[model samples]
Target chain A: MLKGHQTWVFASKPVIRSASAIGGPFEAKGPIAEDFDTLHSDLMIGQDSWEKAERTLLEEACDKAIEKAGLTKETINFFLSGDLMNQIVSSSFGARTLTIPFLGLFGACSTSMEGLALAALMVDSQSAEYVLAATCSHNASAEKQYRYPTEYGSQKPPTAQWTATASGAAVVSANGEGLRVTSATIGRVVDMGLKDPFNMGGAMAPAALNTIEAHFRDRQLPYDYYDLVVTGDLGRVGHSILSELLPKHQIEIPLDRYQDCGIILYGDNPDVWSGASGCGCSAAVTYGHLLRKMKEGTWKKILVVATGALLSPLSYQQGESIPCIAHAVSIETE
Target chain B: MLKGHQTWVFASKPVIRSASAIGGPFEAKGPIAEDFDTLHSDLMIGQDSWEKAERTLLEEACDKAIEKAGLTKETINFFLSGDLMNQIVSSSFGARTLTIPFLGLFGACSTSMEGLALAALMVDSQSAEYVLAATCSHNASAEKQYRYPTEYGSQKPPTAQWTATASGAAVVSANGEGLRVTSATIGRVVDMGLKDPFNMGGAMAPAALNTIEAHFRDRQLPYDYYDLVVTGDLGRVGHSILSELLPKHQIEIPLDRYQDCGIILYGDNPDVWSGASGCGCSAAVTYGHLLRKMKEGTWKKILVVATGALLSPLSYQQGESIPCIAHAVSIETE
Candidate 1:
């Protein structure tokens, strides 16, 4: 977001909103009459491999965000970004572009929330006046590196999410005239030892539920305090499980007001089984949908929770199951 | 630099005075330690693949350095680290473990100096009092992902430096009694357009030479002003070229003082021709040799310039020569 093509496309809108929830009907950024339908970064120069492509996306995102925020790169205190790559390449690439000091973060599909949580802490601690928290996912890179390539024609399970071929970034400023990260609860990385990566939604529900449960308990806030509670990349299966498990755990939130990135991607299409979970799913959805809602002011408080699966090929080969972790952040309009 | 088995048979101590030069006649950190050295990380749970093993090494190195610097996971301002992996996984993993918001950096082999430059800028800006600038490299991971794996038995040229099978890390803190990043000049990536991964030393030498020349000219510092100017993993062939090139550029540094990671690997052994220039080459040499000299007080006012060969298999496939970059940092005793 520093000073990149994507941010220019999004921030060109004459009207910007201030809100907490993407509760109002969704609206994309920029003028509808604009001729440009895409915001792309040229990857021809230094990017050749899939890894390089990932780095390009991250660096471009950070550059655009920093530019959009109108702050010197050195003044930005911390970098908080995540991706689906084995070691979070996207964030690392973003960190390299600017001379600003930074940190890399990981939360699997729930990275945006994790980033937001860390950003909120840095702001609250007065450690940094501004922090950049971004997340990205690439379909081509993810396919070749994580799942099967398009040529493999491997069947995806209902719970699996198609990683986005995009990147989203945000600049979290403590005193900015926009929604602020109010509070966050760092979720425990709980491992139920679930073996199926395809059904990660089912495996990650427990961790999300635990964090949400703790968030409300710690703040003594009621479930109704939040207008929407979003879980990242949890397709239909995990959503169903979370809906049932939350109630079983004596915690309840309205199902209609709950959403997942997996559901959003299909748009009522039957092909997507559950949802999508990649580094980009939460990032694009949050920036596009949630930020748009905050502009319309339909709701006051919204919660975004991102989940990640910690598994390496070697671990899977050794018969190890996936261990899931989730991090939650509350965004509200002041 | 961390807890690892099969490493650190010998390690050079970080003496206060003589460790300023990055590639001078300094002792290595763990390569000289006693036999049966062990490296481990507290946060990461698994390490079966070469990638995971490298991740473990980097994570532990940063964790130990940060802990020694008396900063908490949240207190440390930011995490800066990089490597030469396909997607630069080592730095990403380190960020996840430290959980101190971080940025992933990539100056390729120049990552350490680049990281320190950014950390110094952050400190100067008063954005954060403490910034942990660290870099790591691993032989197995870099080879398999960046070049042909050792198992491939690919013939390496005389110009190539053997990738060091190690990871090295350090903490840059404003309040700590360690070497401070006194001055830094970001190197302009110079592409000599040399097309050979095996002979990366040759490709990177021009960039290293460029940065060295630029730094002295920019700071108005003359040759022989300091004890030494150490260039990162320029291997035997690249080091020789650098020694030859500097004189042509009207900047003369002693050839006896000129060294490369590969030259130090076997230490005058003809068998390990050239030297080591993988990501770990610069890292091990810097943390080992430079830090040792600083501790011993044998030298002062050393210029540590780390160089990187920016090449990927995809680029090679495109018939593109590897373009290289270097970053020069001046580290002096507190």
Candidate 2:
């Protein structure tokens, strides 16, 4: 079913049967560390390169997701996934090993929820019996590709956020006794002419606001409808910006209930500059912490707005401004 | 809508109301030049950078698609697009300008039919009344990112194919009188342990064979069920490989009716090495040339299997074997 505009109301309300989150040493030290299913002591994970290590993380998370659901890889109809890798090699290489029908996506950091939203749509529409949605990000791999390698020890700006080394996977099915996806609002690219690459929170905040605003308006609901409204990997800066922008848009939800995955993941770690930011930041938090809270009867309904900064290294070098987007998914206890 | 193991049997059978193809200088001199809606005389397309030129091509093709359908851009519910660039900036930047709900995809060269297949599914399921499917590739931009800049004038290998400078867009609608999309088979990654990046045709042929075989098996269709079974951007070598591999799989079809977008695009141009190969290669040829032939009653009931070699420059440098996939969509006139 279509909402007013920009949103899809999943009539069947697909259920998330099982999920898994794998975190590295850094993520394991974060605030919601206990929520993660597994934590690695090292980033390499016995792989030759950081890229292969990232692939290993995705593979393990996916394997765990199916096993937790009491299912095998053959039972999953499709693997809808993406990553921050240049051509999304981690997910693609993982798919090669998983041997499932694959749809490779790239939404930068927002890819986790983006994959989940699309997987839910596929399952709800009866296009598949079970679909796997997953995403991963490695701090070292991302730094090497998008910025200077960590080995350089380069001076960074205060606005720079730490990338989490983590992977998250979820299994969406038509019939299940678990968290249900009710609606989704797909986002549009919102470019505010902000060119600084380090200030990704500033670049992404506007997109988050745009999609969040659209979701509320199209659903004919107040800002307080969701028990929690969370933004993906938008650190303290972006979170503060959103607090200011929402009131201006006539949305007046309590700031206490409006949290950001980026800020909440580490819980005021001084080393994490702004906050934890990556595809894995939201993925690990949502599939781990939020779902655990919902299962514990701590929250009834929640909305996740996964935001992405859509800019390439070449685009930035060519003086092109960043294009940002945010996709919102609503989940609730069934 | 789930037909068998992997295929989606669209109940409503969404129609392709209108499509537009824009070709660059190299494509302007190719075999299907006259079939394109617009052709630029220069590779740059009057833009300062090749990336922007590619984005402009996509924008033009999308605008032409909606306009030719006698509809405004606002009526198109979503835009599904992707390209060969890192982070898929061309498509994302294009989406920023297009201002439609965007679902950015990345399937390397197979993005054309992949976009078309997803758009058709959305429309068939009534998720949207109209959706835009498009992909583009700029030769210079691709060469700069994947290999060397064009100005280097480096010696080439006979196995290396030229990337097409072109863009193609199609408007898929729920209620329309046009070519209808019947079924789609989402592909699984198939790796043959071949590592050469120059020979993408060889790398992707096995995946193409995989999906094509699955489509036939799942749909319970015979080998000659369609007038044509065209593989996307396989050039000559992969085309011959498929010819051999299909019979080995015990699926025998008349070889005369078989075609490849890469081999057919340039029509025996020696400068193109084996043949044209890019995201634009299949897109430009299919939406412009083949659809025109279908409208002219040249043939009916065709299966388009778009293939992609999902290897990045980083992955190639990492010494990983190429991973490949091919998505097949059935189109026919009613």
Q: Give the candidate number with the greatest DockQ.
A: 2
Q: Could you give the TM-score of chain B for each candidate, in order?
A: 0.84, 0.98
Report the lDDT tens digits of candidate 1 across residue range A218-293: 6667787889998887778888889898878887787778887666644555555565667666666676667666
Question: Could you tell me the lDDT of residue B20 within candidate 2?
Answer: 95
lDDT of 1 by residue, B249-301 (tens): 88887666666655654466544457766555666567666666666896766
| Candidate 2 chain A: worst-modelled 10 consecutive residues by lDDT | A1-10
Best by lDDT: 2
Predicted model with the maximum TM-score: 2
Question: What C-alpha lDDT, on a 0 to 100 scale, does residue A176 get in candidate 1?
Answer: 60
What is the per-residue lDDT of model 2 for residues A62-176, given as tens digits with 9 covering 90 to 100? 9999999988888899998889998889999999999999988888988887888888878877888999999999988999999986888998887889988999999999997
In candidate 2 chain B, where is summed lDDT lowest over 10 consecutive residues? B1-10
Q: TM-score, each model?
A: 0.66, 0.99
Model 1, position B105: C-alpha lDDT score: 52
